[model samples]
Target: MKSFIILPALASLATAHYDLVFPEWRGDSFADGASQWIYPCANVTQEKSNRTLWPLDGGAVNIHMHHHWTYYAINIGIGTLEPAFTATLTPELHNTTGNGTLCIPKLSVPAGLAKEGDNATLQVVTFDSFGSALYNCADITFSSKAVDPTDCKTDGVKDVIVGAEAAKTSTDTANTTDAAPTPSQSTGGAAASFGGAGAGVVAAVAVGLALMI
Candidate 1:
C-alpha cells in the first residue's frame, strides 16, 4: 500500500506543471511580486557574485516541465538594459502532452556585448494554452574562454533546441504553432498571456522545487 501511495504522488508531480529551474535565480526572484510577471528582470539585486564561469560559446542549460507547453522563449539583457536578444525554444517533439523535459543544447552569446566578467540576465519563460504564463530570471557572468557543452552533463534534462526559426520582428499577434495553438504576446488578448510584453523572445525553465499547484 505504501508503494502504491508513493507512486501516485510521484506521478502527480510528473504531470503537475509551472516552475522555472535553470540559469540560477537572481536575488530574491519572483518574491512577493506580480509585476515580475511582466518584467522578466524585475527586482533583481546583484548584491552577490558567483564564481561560476558560464562559457559564452557552448554553454548548455536544462529545463524540466511538469506538462507540455505551447511556447518557450529566452531573452537576454545586459547591464541595466531591457532584454535585447530573444530566441524561441523548439523541442524535437512538438506539441507534446504530459510531463517532459526541454534542454538548450547551446547558448549563443551576443557579439561584443558579453566579455569576460560582464554581468547579464537571462529570462526563461513559458505560456500555456490557457493564456497563463510563468517566468524566472538568472544572473550570469560571461567567460572569456569558450567552454565545451559536451562536458556539461544534465542526465535527466532534455535538450531544447534554441534558435530564431520561430522569431518575428514584432511581438504582435500571429498564429505560428505547428499543432498546438500559440500564445499571444499582449496581455488578455489571445491563447497565451505575456503580460503586455508580447510574444517576442523568451526561454522556459522548470524547477521541481518551485512547483505551483
Candidate 2:
C-alpha cells in the first residue's frame, strides 16, 4: 500500500518560482500603445510629494519577505479611467515632460530577487525618460514557486477531523475498486500554510489518532 502519511508530510517542504502581473490603460497617443500598468500590486497606494527625497515623489517600496527565496509578482498600474493619467513603470524623473516612462526611476527588474529576509525601501527612483522626471509606485507579491499557493488555514478541529475522515474514506473505497491505485502522499506544503495555527491543529489530530490506535 502507498504511504498514506506522505500526504501530510508534503506540507512542510518549500518550493520557489516567480510571476509578474499588472493592469494597463489606454495611452495618450496611438503609438504609446493601448494602455499601461502603473503598480504591480493588487491594491497599491502611493502618496508622492515634497518632504521625502528618496526617489520619485517620496514614494516608498516596502518588501516584507520571509523564509525561502520568494519570487514576487508586481502590478505596475491597474487600468485607469483618466485620459492623461497613464500608470505604468516609467523611467521618468521629476520636473520633466513628454510621455514619461511608465515606471519611475525604474529599477532593473532584479534577475530573480530572493529571500523573505531580503528587504529594501523604494523611496527614491530614477528611470530614463524623454525629457523630464516623474514619480512611481510599483506593487509586488512574492512566492517560492510559480504555482499559486492557497492561503487556507488548517481550519479547526472540526475541519481537520472532517479532512482526516474524508481522507480515510477515499482510501478505503479505492482498496476495493476495480481501477488500479495511483498512490498516496502527504499534506505538507498547503497544510503548513495554515500559518502558526496549523501546527497546533495537526498536532491535536495526531494525538487523537494515536489514542485510537
Candidate 3:
C-alpha cells in the first residue's frame, strides 16, 4: 500500500510543469499547480511592489522546468497597469529537454521597446509534451545597471532541437514564399540560447537534485 501511494506522488512530481525563477513570480502558484494554467499571469491580477530591476538593454530570464521536455516563448509588456504584450522576445519557440534550472542570459530588449525607469512585465509561456499551455510572469523595472551574465547558469537542461511548431511554421513559410511575411518573421528577432546568451551551443549540465521528479 505504501509503495502504491508513493508511486503516484512520484509520478505527479515527474510530470509537473515549470516555474519562473528570475525577476519574480506575481504570486505563489506552486502550492496549487493547476492554478498555473490560468491565462495571462496565472490568475495573479495584481503586480507586486518590489519589481526586479532588469537591464534596459536586456537581461536574463530563468526558469525551473519540471518536465523532461517543454516549449517556451517569452514576451514583454511595457506599462504599470494592464500592459499590452506587444513584443515577443523569442525569435522562435524553444524546445528544451532535461529538467532543472534553465537560464537565458542577455535576452536583448528590442530597440525603443522600453527605456530606463520604465516599469514593464516579462511573460513566459510554456507548452509541455501533452500540448498544455502554462503561463508565468515577472514584473520588472528597467535599469541602467545590467545583470551579471554569470548570474545565469543551468544545472540540468539542454536545447534538444528546434520546436516542432516553429519547424512546421518555417516549412509552411517556405512553401508560401510569395505570401506576406508575418510581423515576427519580418523583424528578424533574436533568440537567446539556453545556458549561455547567443552562443548557439547545445549544452547539458549534470542534474543537481537527487530526484528530478
Candidate 4:
C-alpha cells in the first residue's frame, strides 16, 4: 500500500504545468505552443489589434494551471515596448498539483502609459520550483472607460473551492503510467520570434524556455 501511494505522488510531481487562457490571446493561439511565447504578442501578423479593449481600471485577467508555482507576474506595456512594471499575482503559491483558474485582479494602467486606440501587450510569467519560468502574452487594445469596482470584482472570478475540488477529481482519471521524459528528449535550441515588424524585436523569453534552462 505504501508503494502504491508513493507512485501517485511521483506522478503528480512529474506532470505539473501552467497555461494562459484569457484576453483571447493576440494570435488566436494556444498557450502550449512554444511559438506563442516568442513574441510580445503571439501571432502578430494575423491581427495587429485585438478587438477586445481591456479596461484600464479594475480589469481582471485569468489563467489556468495544472500545478502551483513559487511566483506569478503580469506586465503590461504599450505596443511592443518592453514592460517596465509588473504585478506579482501570486507570491510563493504552495500547492504543487492542482488544476484551476488563477485570476489577477485590479489591473490598473499606469499614468501616461497609453491612450485609447493604442495597441498593447500583456505578458504573464510564472516560476516553478524546478527553476523553469513559463511565459505567455496577449495583444490587446486599451478601453477608454474604466470599470465599476463592484462589477469588476465579481464578474470574472471563479470559485476557488470548486476549482480545487475539480482538480482533485480529475487526478484519478489522469494518466500516471508514463514516466517523465529524460533530458535527452529536449529540443536542442530555443524558439526564434520577432516582435512587431520593423521594430527589431526579439522573443527573449521564448528563446530562453525552448532551451529549457
Candidate 5:
C-alpha cells in the first residue's frame, strides 16, 4: 500500500517542469516529456513562422519554472539552418529556488558575434533537482529596440549560490564591514561568451512524465 502511494507522488514530481516565457518557444515542448531532452531546440526541426525582434545590445530572458530549485545555463547560436550554439550567455551556472517566473534582465550578445538584422536562436538549459537536464529554445532576430523592462520581473523566486560560490561569499563576508546583499538583490544576468562553432548535443535522459505546457 505504501509503495503504491509513493509511485504516484513521484510521478507528479517528475511531471513538473519549466517553459520559456519570453521571446518565443520553437515548438510545443509540453506535448511530450521526452522531446524536451532532445538537443539543439528540443527536437524542433524547423524555425517558427514568426521571429522575435531582440535588442542588438542586450535583451531579457524570462522563464516560468515549476521546480523548487533549479540551475540554468543560457546559450545562443547564429543562423537559421543548423546554427552552431558556440556562445554561452551565462558566465556560470545559476541556481534559484521557489518556482515561479525567473528573469535575466539583460544578457548581452558576445562582442562581434552578431549584429543588426542577423537571425539567431536563444537556448536555455536547466538542471532540475531530479538531475535531469531540460532544454528549450527561442528564435529571434537582432534589432536596435530594447525589450520592455517590465517584461523581466520575477515572482516568488530567490537566487541561490552554491558550492564554490557559497565558499567565496562566506570569505568575502568575513572580510567586509558592510552587510551582505539578499538573494533578491542579485538576480541571474551576465555577459555572454562567443567561441567557435560546435555541435550542441542534447542528453537523452528518460524521465517518465509529461512536461507541463
Candidate 6:
C-alpha cells in the first residue's frame, strides 16, 4: 500500500495549475499604467468552469517598470520549467516570453476566447528564465540545462511560437480571403472596363455566385 501511494503522490506534485491575470487595463496605451506595478495573485481552482480562477503561489505579485514598459509575470498554474510550454497568439509574431502582457495598443479578444469573455496579456517577456529570447541579456545562459535562475524568477517559461504564428497566419489568410477583386486596377483600360458602369452589376454577380456555391 505504501509503494502504491508513492507514485501517485509524486505525480500529483509533478503537476500544478497555473493562472495569471492583469487588471481590466482601462486604456489604449501601456504608458497609462506604466508607473504603477500591478501585483498579480492567483485566483486557483481544480473546478472546471467558465469562471474558475487559479491562485499564484506568491502572496501578491511583485512587478516593476523598466525601459519603456511595465511588466508582470505569474505562473498562471505551476509546472516544471525543465521544458517550457507554448502558448500562441493569432496574427502576431511568437512572443517567446513566459511573462505575458496584454499589449494595450494591440488589444483584441484572443481568437477563440470570445465565448469566455474578456482577456488580456498583462506583461511582456521575450526571453526564458534561461535567457534565450527574441530580446534580452537573458536571465540565465542556456547550456546543458537551467535548473535555476538569477536575474528573473523561474516559476516557469513559455514560448509564444503558436500565438505569434496564429496572429500572422490569420492576418495573411484574411487579407487573401474575402478581398474585393482589383482587376480594375490592372490596366490602363481599367477605367474603361470597370471604373465605368456596371461595377455594381459585377459585384452582384459575384455575390450571387458565392451564395449559390
- Candidate with best TM-score: 5
Q: If both were scored by TM-score, which would come out higher, candidate 1 or candidate 4? A: 1
Candidate 3, 37-119: lDDT as tens digits: 76677777664435888998888888888888766777788999758777778765467788899888778988888888999
Instruction: Single out the weakest 10-residue window by summed lDDT for candidate 1.
Output: 204-213
- By the TM-score metric, which is better: model 1 or model 5? 5
lDDT of 1 at 160: 32
Tell me the alpha-carbon RMSD of every candidate. 11.1, 23.2, 11.5, 16.1, 9.2, 21.4
lDDT (0 to 1) per candidate: 0.47, 0.25, 0.68, 0.47, 0.67, 0.26
The residue ranges of model 2 lying beyond 4 angstroms of the native Cα positions read 1-58, 78-213
What lDDT tens digits, residue by residue, belong to model 5 across residues 1-213?
999999998885665668888877777787754377777567765644357889987688888888787667777888876577776777544677887898778888777888888988888887654446778888888988745456678887886533445445554664585766455322211111101111111121122111211
For model 3, the run of ten residues with the poorest summed lDDT: 204-213
TM-score of each: 0.49, 0.18, 0.67, 0.48, 0.72, 0.19
Error of 3 at 120 (Å): 0.7
Report the candidate with higher TM-score, 1 versus 2.
1
Error of 3 at 121 (Å): 0.6
Alpha-carbon shift of residue 70 in model 6 (angstroms):
12
Model 4 collision count = 0
lDDT of 3 at 160: 43
Shift of residue 90 alpha carbon in model 6, Å: 6.5
**What is the alpha-carbon lDDT for the whole of candidate 1?**
0.47
lDDT of 2 at 180: 40
What stretches of model 5 exceed 4 Å from their correct place? 1-13, 32-34, 129-131, 161-165, 176-213
